[model samples]
Target: MTRCDWAENADEVMTHYHDYEWGVPTKDERETFELMTLEMMQAGLSWQTILNKRQNFKAAFADFKVDQVALFDDADVDRLMHDAGIIRNRLKIKDTVYNAQQLVKWHAAGKTMNAYLWAFVDGRPVVNRYQTASEVPAQTALSQQVSKALKKAGFKFMGPTIVQSWLEALGILDDHLAKCTVNHLGKK
Candidate 1:
């Protein structure tokens, strides 16, 4: 089957991610938080690198449990910094904790990250019919709004470009190529 060019002839890990998870809408809280953190961690890095080290990240950050990560202190930060299995960016590590704290605060206020984010698209995915990678934009007006909202909500390391990629990764914005066999992802 013809897949998106990004995954065509790609590594096994990236191919699996594209075929199974990319552009697939999900409401699982842990998964959402995990992907958000992954996107944050992916700043200035290759997606392949992140995918390769996903398991390490999942283990290092308590399986991306927001509350568990929110409890991470300087000690955990130091440990993560020394971890060669994952990215050793101190600011990103600290920001992950801080972002989790923000998410916890929002949850306490009766708002979930899933609900807040899905609301942006009126609870539906926005499918795009781009024919080539070049047709896909790095950022959009909607992403700008989301990025600004996230920053105001005390989330760090999430700017428009990152948010755009995250949105696509979350399937809130389906940017599959027109001819991709998995363009309309549905749990496959």
Candidate 2:
């Protein structure tokens, strides 16, 4: 069975992300930070844009290291504004840095972002049996709740749609097509 589902156009970037990483359990802080940052940047834009610019974003954002990104200043943001590799949106860029600071603060608060995020599913991926893309929702009550909580925590740029995708990417929610073998993340 094909390892995907579609909400609309199954563009190359989305397809690649679905096959290679979506729904894959990731425990790395850097990867989590990268995905969260990308999701925030993706607000009001297509995921394709973010995916295409991912390399540039990694280069510009110091490889998505929270500690490094938390150090970004106006100069760093200015440098990013001129770089064609990233979205160059002032608010989003600023939010990325702010989110990094929040991430670090959250870690110091006794839970790493990974723990705080993945804990929503109790450290296990929430399995879903979505058979087609049309069944996929842009947002959910869960995402709204998560979004509200993140916003309350001083993080920026996360909304329901963005949070839902991040949840899927983090493997907090499994969104594989019903026919896909990868749907289970290899859990027997």
Query: What is the lDDT of every predicted structure here?
Result: 0.92, 0.83
Top-lDDT structure, candidate number: 1
Q: Which digits, one per residue and each the tens of the lDDT, describe model 2 over residues 57-157?
A: 99999999899999999999999899987898999999999999888887777778787777777788878888787898889888999899889888888
| Candidate 1 lDDT, 127-186, residue by residue in tens | 998999899999999999999999988899989999999998888998889889874445
Off by over 4 Å in 1: 183-185
Candidate 1 has which clashing residue pairs, if any?
none
Model 2: how far residue 153 lies from native, Å: 1.1
TM-score of 2: 0.90
lDDT of 1 at 47: 98
* Candidate 1 accuracy as lDDT: 0.92
TM-score of each: 0.97, 0.90
